[model samples]
Target chain A: MMSAKQADRLATAGLYAVAGVILALLAGLLGYVFVKGFPMLSWQFITSPPQIFKGGGGVGPQLFNSFYLLVLTLVFSLPVALGAGIYLAEYAKDNWLTRSIRISVEVLSSLPSIVVGLFGFLFFVIYMGWGFSIISGALALSVFNLPLLVRVVEQSIQSVPRTQREAGWALGFSKWETITNIVLPAALPGLITGIILAAGRVFGEAAALIYTAGMSTPALDFTDWNPLSPVSPLNPFRPAETMAVHIWKINGEGIMPDASAISDGAAALLILSILLFNLSARFVGRFVFKKMSAS
Target chain B: MQTVAVPSRVLSSQTHVTALTGPELTRPKLETDRLSVFYGDHQAVSDVCLTFKKNTVTALIGPSGCGKSTFLRALNRMNDSIEGCRMAGEIRYDGIELQSRQVNVLEVRKQIGMVFQRPVPFAKSIYKNVAYGPIRHGVKKKKELDRIVEDSLRKAALWDEVKDFLHQSALRLSGGQQQRLCIARALAMQPDVLLLDEPASALDPVSTAKIEELIGQLKKEITIIIVTHNMQQARRISDETAYFYMGRMVEHGPTEQIFSNPRSEQTRQYISGQIG
Candidate 1:
């Protein structure tokens, strides 16, 4: 019995309401977390080492570990992911072997982070005898990050216009040359975005690092820059716990008086770091795209 | 500079053949012998035998899906990149068998460059786009590259318009300028032949005229083979025109003869705007 115009208006209003509800839920959650956590943030709280039995501890080492692990994970995963992505997008034949490879990537990506953590613990920690070190943790996160990076790279390479490839061919460029000189440059923006997104995931990762990287940090000598030295912060063999793991640990074992406050501050910092990653991704992507695509 | 006997079809009275020894016969630049192209099971071009002379323009005119573009791509082995696309028969350039699998495709492409319908500029400066071919071929000196780029751009009739902005990204150019840049890119290789697949069909009238005029000047050096949808463009630019339909070349002769004389019913009807 409703007129067409009235029905259209009702549908539009319903859609808007649904969208608004989703937006409000996200905003409300972010607002609640920021209100509870922001007060604990300060230069002192961010720069000092944590205390085991007292209040007023900082997350300096854990924050450093988080970034170092993120960098190490990227170093381990990027080349292999880029190669696999290029093979899938540019050269892989539509056969059973390629199909199985693609399916494996999909299945690996969907595996639970906890499951990957357990696998890392069994293989890298016990079997490989890495002793729950930064290397082990980075290897675990690499496994977690590879599939997403591969998919991102593949989609980015495929999204470049076919005409560009044809132009390369017309100008006497071989397939590999064209891919390297033309396609890769054109796909740089998408590749950078994918890398940043993967970095964000790696930065916030907790479950995998807990089992593979261990839940404890050896005392790190900030001035000892030698990577071979056991106590050096740069040593990959030393046990290191990240900020996310720190937050989780503080929440579970509140031995310190300000454990809740430490957890609150760490959680806020983690979220803010992720927000920074996303913002930088957009900035870098746009800058590279403009530099490559226009004068 | 060597003469090959003309094909029987070219000698037949049905084509309104007036000159038995035309320039296409005495100074052939490229010749195809029973060339057929297939995309998987579907035949895109069938039994196409044609000859192009040095320093002249030959236009391939046909309706959409008539395989002119396919035929053009076959000359430089561009069809080799397309999945399931294959070809039969022989393509010869200067008495060398270009269609043989043993032939170096990169060298073939270097000697015979191609320009496509849509303007495709690389994600680089205008100067780099033109200079890329020479650089890849091992032209390392900066002075040599600058000279080559300038010469190629001037040859393509784009030098004056883009001289001051050589460092600008080629993608920033207008569509017509982009097409001209592609031409300059191909010219940088200094190829003996240039294959254009409707190079101006996407441009405005003024741009189209500019391209046509450029083509007229270019034919004096490189043998030019162009595929075009516009009848007027074919008539104006080409020395010889070949009409194709349903993947087959129907009629081919002097441009004026093919346009003015009644050789085949299909050619007449198509030219007169009856059937496309």
Candidate 2:
């Protein structure tokens, strides 16, 4: 019985209401976490290793391990993901094989992290004799991230306006030159988005690392410049417990006196750092696009 | 507005068609013989044989789906990138069989550069856009590159408008300016034949006039083959016109003769606006 104009307004209101609810939920969660955890996050808490005997020590090694792990995973996976993406988007013919590959990528991206963690445990950690080390952990995380990265890169490459590629060809630029100069540069913003998203996901991930990296950072020395030494943060062969794994392990043990405080501070740091990464990604992506495109 | 009035010449409207190649084939700058293009099972362009004299502009005119663009792309082997797209026949350039496996397509492309319908200035700076081709072909000295960039830009008539902002992105330029930048970029390659696929169809009247004028100037140096749906555009810019209909080359003759006195009833009907 209502007017069509009224119905249109109602639909518009419904969409905005849904959007508001989502924003509010996100804001409330972040506010609650900051209030509870900010006071516990001190420079000393982050720089000093865990006080196992007394319960008031810091998460210096775990924090360092998280950054180290993220870097290693990216170093291994980015190139592979980027190459596969370019091949899929630019080179592969539209056939059953190419179709199957796309389907495989989607399937891989949606698989549960825990299942991947189990695969890592059996293959990279046990079968490969990596013994729950940082190397094993990085490899596991690479498998988890590669599919998403590939999809992002492929879609971006595909999205590069067809006219640009045609222009390059018309100019007598070889296919390789065109791809390297035009397609890859044009896909920068999307690549940055993919990197930031993969990094954030890897930062929050604990299940996969737990199976591959194991529990406990055994007295890492930030001063140790030697990359190969056992205690150095750069030692990939050494056992490493990243921040997410530390939080999970500490809460489960329930033995430390200030366990709640430590967990809260860690969660606070995680959320804040993720927020920082997201913001910085926008700036970096824009900077790269502007410089590359010269606009 | 230096408009050159075309003095129309008339031919019989008997619809009798013949190949335009005279018995005294002086080994044209570029020639295609029985060139056909097929996309999988469907024929897109068929049996197009023509000779393009050096330093003359030839316009390919047709209705939509008449394969003018396809034929234009075939000239530069730009269609090679399309999957399931196949070409049969020979395209000769400077007496060399362009389709032969021995000919490096990269070299061929450098000699026969092309511009597209929409302006596709590289996402790079204006200076870089023109410089890219020369750099790809191994012109490394900064002095040489600078000279080439300036000359090409000047030749395309975009230098004065963009000379100050040479370092700025070409994308910032107006559409007309961007299209000119693309022309300069191709000119940097110093191609023998410049293929244009309706390069002004997406442009405004002013831009179209500018491009038409540029084509007139360019025809004094490089052989040009342009495809356009605008019948007036073909008549105004071209010395010769080839009409395409339903994937076949229907007629080829002097532009004025084709416009005023077409030998074919279809051509006459098409020109008089009775059919498209």
- The TM-scores of all predictions, comma-separated, are 0.94, 0.93
Tens digit per residue, CA lDDT, model 1, A1-295: 9999999999999999999999999999888779888999999887788989999888888888998999899999999999999999999999999999999999999989999999999999999999889999999999999999999999999999999998898888999999998999988988998999899989999999899998888888889999999999899999999999999898998699999989988898888878987897799788776676554
**Model 2 lDDT per residue over A1-295, tens place:** 9899999999999999999999999999999889988998889988999877577788888888888899999999999998999999888988999999999988999989998899999999899999889999999999999999999989889989988898888877878899999888887888898899999999889999999988877777788968899878888988899889988988998477998889889889888878787899889889887887673
In terms of docking quality, model 1 is: medium
Report the TM-score measured on chain A for model 1. Answer: 0.96
Task: After superposing candidate 2 on the true structure, give the runs of residues whose Cα lies further than 4 Å from its correct spot.
Answer: B1-25
Which candidate achieves the best DockQ against the true structure? 2
Model 1 segments more than 4 A misplaced? A293-295, B1-27
Instruction: For candidate 2, write residues B162-213 as lDDT tens digits.
Output: 8888888888999999998999999999888899989998899998899899
Residue-wise C-alpha lDDT for candidate 1, range B1-276, written one tens digit per residue: 434443321111222222323454474788888999999999999999898988989999988999999999999999999999989988877655676544568878888999999999998889989988999989999999999999999998999999998988898899999999999999999998999999998999999999999999999889999999999999999999999999999998999999999499999999999987
All DockQ scores: 0.50, 0.55
